[model samples]
Target: MPRTFDGATGPVAGRFAIVVSRYNENVTGKLLQGAIETLTQAGIADDDIDVAWVPGAWEIPLIAQRMAETGHYAAVLNLGAVIRGETTHDEHINRQVSLSLGELSLVTGVPMLFGVLTVNSLEQAIHRSGGNVGNKGMECAEAALQMVRLLAQLPE
Candidate 1:
């Protein structure tokens, strides 16, 4: 038999930081709501979660990095919606934000959950935010919880 390490069960305790983009508030608002709800449901108190509102997706990484560097949070959730426009602007933002968040996670040794929605259309963004596609915010929050628990089981 082999021992398996899983985050399936455990008491998740720690403060969490959510860096949400104010752009596309129509979508980001929902994402923020879902993330907060999920965190609270998982035994995280409201005070345990801090939220920072950035101007847009491009600004998420900087704020998230600051929060993660403080070593005050067990995980950081970055939520936003980048709807593709006439140019490749969305592509650049998406790729760079994703890369930056990943790097911050590695450098800070904290779980950084990427919940940014890089969708082709507003309809698609709606679908993922809280529509039939499900809320990415909720998904990210769940991932954060799992990572927090999983990391605790690993050797440091």
Candidate 2:
């Protein structure tokens, strides 16, 4: 049988970085809360999780790249909200940020998660931040920890 290395689900034992977008503070704030709660519940210390606020979803990637390059954080979680507007600006922002974050993770060998909420309306954004659809921030934190553990198990 081919062997598969599965990441362990538990508290991450290293520093963590969270980049948040202030564009939709009401919504993003909820996501930030969820992410923090998840990390704390998983046994991560409050002091270990660092947070940075940027103007909007468009700015998450570069900050994440910088945080990843520092090698101080085990993983970086990006939380933002880009609600669609008349010009389809949200679509562009979402795609570019996702792509950039993906490339950063690949090149830096750091685990970076895109937790930004791309929705057609504020209602939909609210739904995912911590409402009906469930919280994506918590999921991001969990994913970060999982990836950290998985990387630790790999040959470095």
Q: Which 10-residue window in model 2 sums to the lowest lDDT?
A: 3-12
Compose the digit string of candidate 1's lDDT tens values, residues 61-152: 99999999898999999999999999999999999999999999999999889999999999999999999999999999999999999999
Q: TM-scores of all models?
A: 0.98, 0.95
Candidate number achieving the greatest TM-score relative to the actual structure: 1
Cα-based lDDT at residue 86, candidate 1? 100
* Candidate 2 residue-pair clash tally: 0
Which residue pairs of candidate 2 clash?
Answer: none
Residues 1-156 of candidate 2 have per-residue lDDT tens digits of: 976777875435899999999999999999999999988888899999999999998889989999999989999999999988899777888889999999999999888898999899999998998899999898888898889888877776
Q: Candidate 1 at residue 128, lDDT?
A: 96
- lDDT: worst 10-residue window of model 1: 2-11
- Model 2: residues >4 Å from true position, as ranges? none
The list of candidate 1 runs beyond 4 A from truth reads none
Clashes of each: 0, 0
